[model samples]
Target: MDTFWKDLEAAAEARDADALTELMRAAAHDGGNGEPLGIRYDAARSARNNVDKYAEN
Candidate 1:
């Protein structure tokens, strides 16, 4: 796989929302499309929600 995908996978595995967001922004910028940005926003939101849910347990 490409480095870009590797980095994304790493961030996801690490649960690093900030890193994921940054990568998504970069991807969206390069692609000139809103899809990546939307994905990034969702990923960050999901990560935060996951953390919050875990904390409630």
Candidate 2:
């Protein structure tokens, strides 16, 4: 989880939308079939929102 956050932060810092999407997909896949889709969606949303918010600054 920490690694995911760190990588997300880096992607956000770089302002790489592709990397962000790929990371989210990778995270969801890693979460396994038992994991709920909502959780992955939320995680991706949070990361994307944060990146967009900070990009405006």
Candidate 3:
């Protein structure tokens, strides 16, 4: 949704890694495509890793 994007943008601008990860998790869970548990787990893990990697920049 528009709100999600706006919030994500705001989080990114603020360099809030935790908020970014949480938003990614929310999007993955609410996508409504019946994603498999494994896929969701992978996504969350990837999100965390990305947040960590970027936070170092």
Q: Which candidate is the best by lDDT?
A: 2
lDDT of each: 0.60, 0.70, 0.62
Query: How does model 3 fare in lDDT?
Result: 0.62
lDDT of 2 by residue, 1-57 (tens): 247666767877787777888877777667534566656556766777777877799
Give the worst 10-residue stretch by lDDT in candidate 2.
Answer: 32-41
Writing each residue's lDDT as its tens digit, candidate 1 over 1-57 gives 235556766776776767866775666555424354456545545655665566579
The clash count for each model shown is 0, 0, 0
* Model 1: colliding residue pairs: none
Residue 52 CA displacement from its true place in model 1, Å: 7.6
- Candidate 1 lDDT (Cα, 0 to 1): 0.60
Between candidates 2 and 3, name the one with more favorable lDDT. Answer: 2
